[model samples]
Target: MTRSIDTLLVANRGEIACRVMRTAKSLGLTTVAVHSAVDANARHAREADIKINLGGAKPAESYLLADKIIAAAKAAGAQAIHPGYGFLSENASFAQAIADAGLIFLGPPASAIIAMGSKSAAKALMETAGVPLVPGYHGDNQDYETFREAAQRIGYPVLLKATAGGGGKGMKVVEKEADLKQALESAQREAQSSFGDPKMLVEKYVLKPRHVEIQIFADEHGNCIYLNERDCSIQRRHQKVVEEAPAPGLTLELRQAMGESAVRAAQAIGYVGAGTVEFLLDARGEFFFMEMNTRLQVEHPVTELITGQDLVAWQIRIARGEKLPLTQDQVPLNGHAIEVRLYAEDPDNDFLPATGTLDLYREASAGEGRRIDSGIEQGDSISPFYDPMISKLIAWGSNREEARQRLLAMLADTQIAGVRTNLAFLSRILAHPAFAKAELDTGFIERHTEQLFVKPSTQSAHFWKLAAAAWALSEPKTTRQDDPNSPWANNCGLRIAQPRRFLLHLACGEEQQKITLREADLAGVCLTNDRLILEQHGQRTSHSAIRQGNTLYLELDGQIHSISAVDSIALAEAAAHPQGGLTAPMNGSIVRVLVSPEQQVAEGDVLVVLEAMKMEHSIRAPHAGTVQAIFCSEGEMVSDGMVLVEITGDAA
Candidate 1:
């Protein structure tokens, strides 16, 4: 029986809410959006047919307040509620409350949520169900010494994870005994903040295990099926950056084993609707159950693309007491799909979350096998109160190679201006040789951090091309009406002669790219032996500039390039320090300083520890150097790229 739900209330914000609204609308359901004061004008809120204000700016005052959400649902006259992925999605109590209020919760049952909500309890249940699990301590004792001893017994390099939470928050990798206490404290704090539970569990860290998860959907009639697996091994700071369905290197035999395990896990909990069973696969092909998310995952779209299924629709069907429409053997997965998370973050600066209004956010066309799920608009403000992800770019292709190429092209065409982002960094990683071969693991980012965030080479001639374009755009010009013989009169009525030369400074690290441009034409703009062609079409502009912010204003390729003049001296100074020493990565307090003035250290040695975003990051020595000075002390707050230590070493 396909019961129609007239109105559904979305109890979350950002991308996931917008994503849910699309599915709800397709099902002929009128959507209601609940938002906090900060999000009253958000994209999701504005798009919904009905909107309700929760009357507060903070999470607790609005989204996290169960009563407030319930009232908003009732006020909007919604018959069902979609929690999206975060906030209260996994809150079993909230789920139960929604059911009690006679409103359908578009997720698994309350019992299923509670069963898999606690990491320790879920591991125990999985073990009982004969699912392979990592060997570690998931006991009830909360003694620090006991955990420390247990970690040592499990061996060094263990992972401390929040037993009551999901996401990357409240997680830490302890490589040695010296860092155990700090890691534990940090994890506990983060766990408390994220899940209101500070208890954590320790597990042996799998050095090179692939992070793969199985997407499963179950109906009320006890029918459950796995939608296939996704490889989420490409991560930084324990958070997934890129995810792909039909894991590149997985074998059919292994996939069967993992898929069966995932099904069994879901069945064990009597789960309904959409959920995911995550696992860690070792190089030896042995797999261990990580955890079960009893709610929709952020990476579900990848599974949908590969399986040709509407997962959200399936969830709605199950909520309405529908039986499974398909069987295990009947389900099919075709082609390879990859999704990359575009965030407002600085990868070179330790992937710190950035906040600002999106001045320009444009995604590639849907054709050519590209799909984009985004929540931000051109003027949307990325607030510091929530996750910094701006959008998820997904691409599908006939095969892995085609998918990879299409994804790269999509990224190239996609542009986000105004705030710093990980666009270039993501592109570099996708194009990396290791990534192309699908040699992936949780440590992939850490192992290739240097190559991944390498400073742009100054010796490249493209640097001069960008400088020339910047100079040309900055030069003052007169219309063609001013002079009939002007070169600008040839095509459009734009004319310029002896345009004033403008200076530009581009800094990569310690190196500086300085140049001046006076004129620009179809052939190319000249700058100290460098020539750059200015392709113009309407307001769009494209140039061979190597650095960001090189092009100013021009009409090229149906896009507008508005160039702003930057201080040449500041650019020179920035360029002078091409390798700008060791700096703090995010907005965090300096927990410790490992070096003092004139202290010599080798590459990769710990220089400073910064605690930010509820995680601890150790800033290491870039190369062999003598520490010239230290700019901060313990407990001092620092922003992204704030120089914490200066090292004198090889210039190159």
Candidate 2:
């Protein structure tokens, strides 16, 4: 039996919600967007035909409330609810609820999701179905002795994974016996917070393995197919950051073998719509099933680019009881495609998530085989309620090298300011020799740390010189004829007068500098549309500049630098205080305060642990000092740069 869907409600936020709405609209189906309180004016809401207010900003008060989402869909007259990846996408109860309400769930059946709900249970099912399982203990016991015994049996370097974990939460790699207890406790606490499950699985860790996944789809009828594979080996903290289709060095025979196994895994569960079966390819090319994601994946765009098929559209059609459109052989994989996730996080500061207004955001030119899938625009804030992934940059070409080349240019051409991002980090990874050579593994990013996390030289004299000139020339009367005091307004745009020098103050991160600029140093000083253009030594340069309050952002030379403008008065006031404060690196909840008031601590000693976007970051003592005050407490929500603890240097 088949039914037509006239409207779809996307039960998610940010990029995925926006991504789903695009396809739904093109199909002539009305799209409904459900947003939290914070996303009242979000891009997804603007793109959707109908918007529903879910009232609260946090997931608990908004997106995670399945009842509220169903009510919104019903009120908007949506025939289906599409859980885009995160919130309730893989939730078995949510799927059942949708079915109970007689609304279409644009994903696998509830029974299938339950089949693969727990990692340990999923492994048991895979083994029974003749699928290759990674050697590990999959049991119901969670005692300390049980984990210890299993780790010893599996040998050293085992992985403790939360049975209900995804997106790398509650997963840790322990290299030796000494670290087992601490790792276990940390994984348990994280798993409890993330998935509400304390159960875990101990797996024989695969060293130097490649993380690969097969995209599978099924229809209401008895038909299914695999859309080849994607290599997601490049990661940080077990979360995938870059993904590509048609893994670089995989042979066709192996691809087919793995694809069929993935099909079997899907068919065994009676799965429908889009799903992913993940596996780990070891050094010897042998593969073992890891787990199955019974929902749409975050990296589904790369698979779509290579196959030239719209996976989201397919999911919609499948929910309408349409049969699989293509057989396994008819599924075409035209070329190679690569996708990099752009996050609002600082790579240098342990990749802590950032929260702030986008101040200035400009994408590279697309439609030339470069695709940008984003959920943000200029001036939108990256709120603390959800994931910090702002956009995805994807490119396709006839081969791997061509795709890689396009990515390098696309990333370099893109610009983002205000909040700190991992753009420079991504560029460094793409330019690395190993990444270019396609010698990839799950540990590749950590293995070549020095080559990938390049530190920038922010104190260059030439950069300061340019900043000073740009700042002074940015004055309105500098180029207008109405003001007679303009230095270049009357001298035929030439610096024929005495060189007038003025100090231009700027600050970025922890360092601040004031550079003196004279009119004689600038060749071309023009401010047009908030951009500064000039020539130096026959080379032209361009920068997109925006001044918001005391902060100034300059996007030039393939990078965005954020600086705070300072004046003599403000500088003097800051110097008078002569005190340094420790601030929260991102929007997060304070897990615990490790030090008491007036507690003496040494440099590098851990003071507080903050959790944001599903990762823990330690706030350490910057120098040996006494803890003068504590501003935050356990379980308190804090915004970015909110001072958490104050420290005063010990009297020398």
**Best-fitting candidate, measured by lDDT?**
2
Cα lDDT tens digits for candidate 2, 295-399: 889999889988889999999889999998899999998789989999998888678788899987889887656999999999999987677899999989888
> Over the stretch 575-617, how does candidate 1's per-residue lDDT look in tens digits?
8877556776556668678788988899888888776534456
Candidate 1 vs. truth: CA RMSD?
Answer: 6.3
Q: What's the lDDT for candidate 1?
A: 0.79
- The positional error of residue 16 in candidate 1, measured at the CA in angstroms, is 0.9
In candidate 1, position 259 carries an lDDT of 93
What lDDT is reached at residue 289 by model 2?
A: 91
TM-score of each: 0.81, 0.93
Error of 1 at 219 (Å): 0.7
Each prediction's number of clashing residue pairs: 22, 0
Deviation in Å, model 1, residue 472 alpha carbon: 2.3
